[model samples]
Target: MRPITAIGFDADDTLWQNEQYYRLTEQSFVDLLGEFAEGAHITERLLEAEKRNLAYYGFGIKGFTLSMIETAIEITGGQVSTDTIAEILEIGRNLLRHPVEKLPHVEETLEALNGEYLLVLITKGDLFDQERKLAQSGLGDFFDAVEIVSDKNATTYRRIFSKLADGPERAMMVGNSLKSDIVPAIAAGSYGVFIPHALTWVVEHVEPPTDAPRFRQIEHLGQLGSVIEAIKAA
Candidate 1:
């Protein structure tokens, strides 16, 4: 119920077409590795590699490319061909080159809230890739500040909110990932707004904190304004 002084947003699936592209790339990876392993097995192994490599590679297409290569190598017992590796690399490049498509109502919502509140983009991923996506998004100017951090945690939200706005208590975080954007921001004493994306990555999946006073879930970005108003009146 604290006056919302600033708002933080998660960029990936929340703002534009991200997870869907990743899903397509993942299917491409499976197809590329089909000769060495079954599609299901390949997908399972690649997911395992991705999860294991998160600490080493963090997040983004580059890490995903590396994980796919590692999975290929592991599946083939180190006999995977160089050409396949090159193809996998190309898949990552394609992901990087994919045009940014802003979701429905995203521009309108940002335009509506741009001057009314401090809008900060707080997303986590490879800095270059994140920056590239933001630049391509064309929604970059709407944000007052941007924080591309290594991870999202309670501490991360607290630090960002304290420095960029009044504090976490006076800020709200809106994103698709309950794990990365909602839980941590709420834990940091900020309102956590969940905007569901159809193709959210499995790794980011988690139960919603339905009992939390600061937690809210909306069908899409279009419903965000009503949620904000309700939050204000709460």
Candidate 2:
């Protein structure tokens, strides 16, 4: 393996348990839905609605709020009263105040890795929400550059990577989501290191390729230091 000149990181689960926060808010939405409409049907409708809304709103708070509204209307056949909509909006607003509880050893590990690699933060979601989390987490300073991407597909990664000063060959992407991070990073001619998160959404999965040389796997962010050291040694 070539010595890595720079390293890129995926935000969210890679650095902290982001989806769990979303999941908590989602449960709140589901509970609210039960009062006005079909019970667990909230989950079903939101999933279906987000499948389409993802194109327009991408991922993040705004998109999620829209999904909540759309799901309510879809499940209720437009009979969802204003009261239900108000409750949903209130729940979404409450999420803005959601606490950010980080994964274990994240801060210490990032501190250890910062000086050794040109670290960049690459994440995809609503800019405001992502930025809010980044700011609140106090982890932004560890990265040399911050990229809040609109999507994490192969094409998007390819385009963003080509714009980097180091180029893909000398860069490695370390992240949690196989679909959004590893697969796309590998496709972009970069080395990809997968860090499996404890909690993951179904949408963030990808079938691993049988013949990929540039992909590696680790259990968590703390394991990344060894991979970096090995790359440097080689």
Instruction: For candidate 2, write residues 173-215 as lDDT tens digits.
Output: 8888889888988888888998887677777877765379888
- Which residue pairs in candidate 2 have backbone atoms (N, alpha carbon, C) closer than 3 angstroms, thus clashing? none
What are the clash counts of all predictions, listed in order?
0, 0
Mind sharing the TM-score for model 1? 0.97
Q: Best lDDT goes to which candidate? A: 1
lDDT of 1 by residue, 69-137 (tens): 999899999999999889999998999888888888999999999989999999998898889989988
In candidate 2, residue 80 scores what lDDT?
Answer: 87
Candidate 2 clash total? 0
Minimum summed lDDT over a 10-residue window in model 1 is located at 1-10
lDDT of 1 at 176: 96
User: What overall lDDT goes with each candidate model?
Assistant: 0.92, 0.81
TM-score of each: 0.97, 0.92
